[model samples]
Target: MKIPFLGGRQALLDPTLVAPMSTAARPELTGGRRIGVLVQHGFTGNPASMRPWAQDLAERGYAVEMPLLPGHGTRWQDLNKVTWDDWVATVEGALDKLVAENDAVVAVGLSMGGALCLRLAADHGDDLAGIVVVNAAVDTLRKDVKLLPVLKHAVPAMPGIANDIKKPGADEHGYPMTPLRAAASMFAGYAELRRDLPRITIPVLFFRSAEDHVVDISSSRAINAGLSSKDFEERVLEDSYHVATLDHDAPRIFAESAEFIERVTREQQG
Candidate 1:
């Protein structure tokens, strides 16, 4: 099947866009590993945005895996056809890869990725080292989400995509339209995890954007207030919007994640 457009409105189909994971995208499995981190991306975003945060953790001597979820990266239509299980499986694979190599493993994700991380932690119970989510999607009611209750059940038109800042010299292709069922499934995944929030005992770091237009602020508050882990800490990024991972507030993400990693590896979860 033909791939979907990427961004900037072009029919670009570069292999570099959706090829298998680059070698650098996977963390090294050296014997001296400390913290193993699996980083997941948001709804329409590929692994590119999380690359910086992964690299930041790696530089701090922590292992990081930025997995590109199935159906993501190349085409939004591909994502529309995917199930939540497929997405969760992709993250599970990366998390296993990291935990297998390192002595300790902590899951970290941004946006939808954060939900994925939370799911893994809750499922594992006390087996996980920790989980940290930045601007996670607990309950997303975007200002633009009005009247969609009808469009959601009446007729399922494939929804369009949205983008924030992109890396320089990035290839341009149009975002494939989003399927409404896909959105519902992904939301259900977060909802299921949200219910288990009070059951998650691992350390969690919740970050929010004061001006985030993508994720709902109430959702962030709900996750912070609902988690069972008493070691949770919430930080609000004042300088960025929804896509704080790549926005100007990215440094805060790196710093917070680094601290989370340090604490997890040090067994500071008390």
Candidate 2:
């Protein structure tokens, strides 16, 4: 699908274009066996939400790459035209690039971004050094989600769960509306990820908010139960919502993840 932009130029299904209020982080040049971290934002969201975490890692001498998912960070209406495949392909391509240049690569994501990171862990297994997620969802408690198949056809869109941050003035730069078709595809991706959870055995770190309006805590429980990672840890975000990466607990998430990355990569290097 072609999205017309300024100057009458069209966006060519490119997930790399830095959207307004969103920026794609480039890996920093660090010496030695460099580490690469692929950070992804949640569905209906852009790299803006994940940028802070990516920048944190970059400052610590780790190479970071954040890709804008297809149909995201653009007009919400365009989301109806894309599917889960488009989102997966974008991150997969980003992962390929990072793996090639870095000694060890870590995947970090939030919400649906977390689901995608889990997908990478499952697909790459031992190839990945570790995985980190904030308020990731593999399953949810929203009853309406079960009717997505029927609702997606009748209801074109619904109220979005963007900017679910408790902080007074923080915005995730997410779309204002949630296109049903895109949401259905996202749920479908979650189902597939759940089924393959056991395939992910790498070191995994999860940050869950104590009060998340968008994704219920049940999703975290399900993920913890399903994952086969022998080295797994869960951190509680006491003062945040679903968008914890942009909320009050964001610093803790960043600091803990940086420390986690160091420990995991050191083990791998040894």
Candidate 3:
């Protein structure tokens, strides 16, 4: 019984989820001037999760790169083959290339990718045009986590068994079933960066799901309260799950992100 590459995930297993390992000769970006929107998927997710959002943004005129994480897009065992740092590096590399081609670079990331973008805004302040974080996993110690402590160990550590029996949505992606070590690394990165949130001074947009089950909803306020940037905006998605980027609010997310790019591009042009 050989497991297929997709494992019957949310997508139909077409194109096998294109990874962004090689930033080779990409076609010239049209519809807008040198603006790139680099997308980051969740811990166990592949590029497929961000595909809808990427396509939406691309249609509105932005170069998008939804990179498959180092060990993701494959099997659970492969995730263990890489570390948190490797995942972060991939994101940074993608952003670098986007910035290289485009005069302005903006980023929109989900979950851990959100954390990576925040860190980049803090460190690479001068380069970024802006950032939009949807369900940004800035902090891990949410009130819900305390309420349902068992989920922490059960979901990622023992996937297909301990995962979210309450909501089958999580199981749909067929995300890495078992990556306990990788799970721990995720929180560590989030924690290290939370202390540095104030360092992020670029114009930022934050999308928080009002009915989120995974990430701490308060993170939106936390990011808003902490970031040094004066041009920060936060919105709440009334109807959606943790992965709002793939769920109901995807289009609104794309629209607002496009607006962010346009606003920043205009500012740069002016």
Candidate 4:
């Protein structure tokens, strides 16, 4: 579909690149422990960004569910038609499925994916072992955001915020334009998310890029200040940008997250 604001050109969405992924747990690899993980991608992006991370966890004997959220993995214009609740419902369903089949479950998300994970943690803390969020955005400092209520009616989309990586060739395969109506919906829900932050009592591993063009430090500060989890740990990704999952520091994120998942799930089982 041709995005409205962008010139009349159809977005080239590769099916393989944006496909949802699922991997069953191999208990023998983890000494017969069944652990499941819900991995999620960001707004305007699809499972491609989290595929490697999900695969890494799956290789470590964890059941992984990397779902393509509603209004994503398709055209940017599709995103404009979906609400924040649609995105949340998709992740919640994925998490629910993982919880039913595993002894323990952890959620991992990037950017808006991170926000969705936090929401899951708030509502389903007892169902989750822990959560890992990379460059999760809960709030924005942009003055343009204030105009969204009026601007969304006038404009269909703005510039895209995908693929903010320091590594040269890495791509998240996200939409080229940011859907204004969807962006406003995501931003509007942040107030309630912030209010519910104190309900997330499970362990949280937060990763923040030292330099991110798309999301500033305000979000990290809000998260750090609002979370009620005593087990929260924040790590700085010095070498990457907002899309840290596919950037130079991606290996670090994958390794540390795996370790965190292992430890948290083991503790939950105990």
Best by lDDT: 4
TM-scores of the candidates are 0.81, 0.89, 0.80, 0.96
Expressed as tens digits, the lDDT of each residue in 1-270 for candidate 3 is 122444544233334554542232223544346677788877776666677777777766677777877777666666656777898788888888888877677888877778878988887878888888877877755443343334545554445211221333532243536576676666667767778888888889888888776666567766877889988888888766777766667778887777787887678667
lDDT of 4 at 105: 94
> What tens digits encode model 2's per-residue C-alpha lDDT throughout 201-244?
99999999999999997888889889998999988889999899
Candidate 2: where is the Cα deviation over 4 Å?
1-31
Tens digits of per-residue lDDT for model 4, 39-79:
99999999988988988898888999999998888888889
- TM-score of model 3 (CA atoms): 0.80
Tell me the lDDT of model 3 at 171. 28
Query: What's the TM for model 2?
Result: 0.89
In candidate 2, the residue pairs with backbone N, CA or C atoms under 3 Å apart (3 or more residues apart, or in different chains) clash, namely none
Candidate that would win on TM-score = 4
Q: What do the candidate models score in CA lDDT, each in turn? A: 0.68, 0.83, 0.69, 0.91
Candidate 4 least-lDDT 10 residues? 1-10
lDDT of 2 at 56: 83
User: Which residue ranges in model 4 land beyond 4 Å of their true spot?
Assistant: 1-7
TM-score pick, better of 3 and 4: 4
